[model samples]
Target: MTSPFLSLPGAVGSPVAQHYGAPVAEQRALDAGDAAVDLSHRGIITVAGPDRLSWLNSMTSQQLLGLAPGVSTETLLLDPNGRIEHAIRVVDDGERAWLLVDEGSAEPLAAFLNRMRFALRVEVADVSADFAAVLAFAGGTALAALRALGPVVEWADPWAEVTRGGTQYANGEHAGAEWSAVQLVFPTERLGAVARAVAPAGLMALDALEIRAWRPSRVADVDERAIPHEFDWLRSAVHLTKGCYRGQETVAKVHNLGHPPRRLVMLHLDGSEGELPVAGALVFREGEASDPEARPVGRITRAALHHEWGGIAFALLKRSVPADVTLAVRAGAEAADPQAPVEGVIAAAQEMIVPTDAGATRTIPKLKRL
Candidate 1:
């Protein structure tokens, strides 16, 4: 399908309008629920048959056996060691269960499901080509507009609180308690009509807001070594009481007797220098970056100029890094326009997203003196 955003002014990216023109303004609009994001590039898959929910419950990290229609939840597909491979947002509508994932994830997930189907009844298909998604926050024009596209499938984010049988590794109330992101699915052919009803913003707008909410994304935050514990993902994606599935051993072991070696943090960059470090910038302790012998303790995964927060980012750091110490993110020379380079270390204050004491729920009893 040709992008409805292809010809949009100030649009530039894989499709168009990564930001329509004014990114900060666009972000403000999005926060106020006035705009929707064009997500034609995202992947959508469907699982159909009488055994759909039960089969999925037996394979993934979330409990889906009796999932009611219209409820929104997410699950993670983990490798044997409990390393995250895919993060999937799911919704069932009686006939079939929909799996919404980041771009490039639909094909592999569907293929894996196909091979696992032995007979009992389940069908998997990547319908990304035929269907497209529109992203919106609750109670806004974009959400209302999408609802007008009736008989549509919608999935609201389950981030405001911990789900059933889930544990929140992040202490205190969730920063995103009021967050209300929703995805509306529509036919690819209706791109033109949908575009006309909802005002469009770029993906940048959506991402900036997510950063402020301290949301951990699979594509941006996960590495080959990433486990659900590192990003505090158990709050929404992992069910502690669910029956055994792949990677259950590691998930259980870590929850009971271990801690995630790495932890996710929200970085409050010193925007006084007028520079925001790009993703992958090196993170150091205070003034350590100047020493050639000193190694970075972490790396920025996502950075954006938030509408309300200014320059901020999400970084994954070694859990041993002291929480009270101010950190540094080195924003190097600008390769795009080097005339006035942004060559300097940006001071960062850490906001703990995942605490160092996040896990180890069980205590081993000491043996009595013999």
Candidate 2:
């Protein structure tokens, strides 16, 4: 099972592409809508049968029973404790419902769905081996041409606008307001030919764009303790009024009565240390030079050096941490080693992504007196 993309010149791979030689140049090409990235590393799951929509709606956070064909939406599977377990990008093509997931999750997710179908007329299949996914940004012409070739299902990102039954926690203009990215799924056999036909961009380009948009990627952002509220995922992934589902009680209670214990923030690294902090880097409150015991308030989830914005990252921090607070992230260190702490601590300025007062449900009236 050789990847056709690996045959391309300058092809590099891990969980995603490191780069294709000129990382900056490739990023620019992608930003200008002149390139496409091979996202075949991602997995695909297909659910077909009459009960597909209703069954899915009953399981995840999003409202999917009425999901129109060609409409793109995302859903999350949470534990009963409300911790995020899985985040799925979904779309329907009239006949079949497609679930696009992170690499290594297809088999388990498909199996879970299959087991959930006791006597329901639903069939789930792991089709990752049969299909290839390409992510294209500003790739209107190439995408249209690809659609003409055969049946191509494109899931347009709905992050640009607040979706129905969702709540937006960010105030003012958000970077995702202008985000224009789409996932295109086609037969795996056509991958090599499609790569030859379209302009090729590396995964670095995709990472830069996603980070700039403050897009929360499941694989990158979700940890064992992550909840949807922490990332403001209700902005696009959860339906507030949706029927009962696992973790729905927690979701409702948090939105109406409580606040998320942590919040997601974008950090603009000071870049004075001449290095970027790696993911899982511990973040601390900026303390005095002599105060060697600065308290840790957060941990970096994703970090990247943008072509234009320099170094930036997504960090999940204690919700009490102010939106305007300056922080420091330990950089160039072995995150796995606790005793060998890195000396270089990079300064970072917080840009609020999720507001402090994010989840105040309107249904909950202001209490006058007890």
Candidate 3:
């Protein structure tokens, strides 16, 4: 079997985790100093037309009308009911806009955009197979390396545009500090040059970095039933007043009045190490039966062994759960196969405590003037 990490310079390495999972160390470096992620699996949707700007503006929560060359913004593709179908980072190159999103959202998002193309001269295609996208977090030397590669075109705070020769790249946050969510596109033949230029890594490192930074992805990291508010994607994605879109009403109402029934929190485990909670396990504050089974206080989203915290995890827990709550991971068993009970309790295998400042306040600029 192959290892789950990719080698890189100035770091231990990156992750080779499935496209959906980034390793815990990569996530930590990303949040603390500098790091990079291979977004080769992310889906890219291209939209071009005179109506592209206005049309996309009418649909997403981002204020695309003001987007100029070399700038980017994160937004959500919401269902009619305000649930996030997917989260996307939008990049405007003046002539065309690119939607960078989760790998799973490619087909559905393409179909949605294609179906919406009525009189508007818009075309949407799933370009996932065409591009080699990677995300980098650099400051000082790393930033200099990137700037040497291209002209810094625009700025969206941590996100900016840099172009080298004629190739264009977009920069954004993987965790924090100085970062660049870079994309390189060309005939598949030229991928080697791009890889060498940027230093390729695996998805495991990216997940590690994401865990440290507290960035939650949709797949195993979150329940599909989760509202966007719960993940705090609104901090970076949803614009307060970008006019109306599909689920703007719910977004607005929830943002102003109601709190999300649950929230995403970072957890530190006791790590006694008998049987840890897997990615989709149920988490109970005190024990089961206190709450409906369907209504678990939280679900274990991403779990990884941290160099500092030992066993660290990201969970979507109820707001009512105490920060210091002792939680248990309920083990699952199959029928007729009773080495033990199919639904046996792990018996306080680990104490689940929220990491300090998991939900700290962030100050975002009102405008993209930079």
TM-score of each: 0.95, 0.94, 0.72
Per-residue accuracy of model 1 over 9-53 as CA lDDT, tens digit each: 777777546887888888888888888888888899999999999
Candidate whose TM-score is highest:
1
Alpha-carbon RMSD of each model: 2.8, 2.2, 9.5
Q: List ranges where model 3 is wrong by over 4 Å.
A: 1-35, 140-187, 274-276, 286-295, 331-370
Global lDDT scores for all candidate models: 0.86, 0.83, 0.57
By lDDT, the better pick of 1 and 3 is 1
Local error of candidate 2 at 363, Å? Answer: 8.0
Tens digit of lDDT per residue, candidate 3, span 1-370?
1122233334232233332233444455543434444555557778888888888888886667767767666777787778878777777777778787776788888898888889997777787776545455554233344344452132232222221111111113333333444443333344344345543334655554556555657655655576666765665666766789988887777665565667776666666653445676666655652333334566777666654656666777776776666765555533112232336444333332222223322344588677
- Give one digit per residue, the lDDT tens place, for model 2 in 1-370: 4667677788777644667788778877777777778888889999999999999999999999878999999999998988998899999999889999987788888888888999998889999989978877654566655555564688888888889999888889888888778788989888877777776778777777788888998888889988898897998999999789999999999888888889999999997666877788788888621134556788898887788998888999998988877888876666423444556678889988888877766466678986
Candidate 3: count of backbone clashes, pairs at least 3 residues apart or interchain: 20
Q: Which stretches of candidate 2 lie over 4 Å from their true place?
A: 139-141, 288-292, 336-338, 362-370
Residue 360 in model 3: lDDT: 26
Off by over 4 Å in 1: 333-342
Ranking by lDDT: 1, 2, 3
Question: Candidate 1, residue 175: CA error in Å?
Answer: 1.0
Summed backbone clashes in each candidate are 1, 0, 20
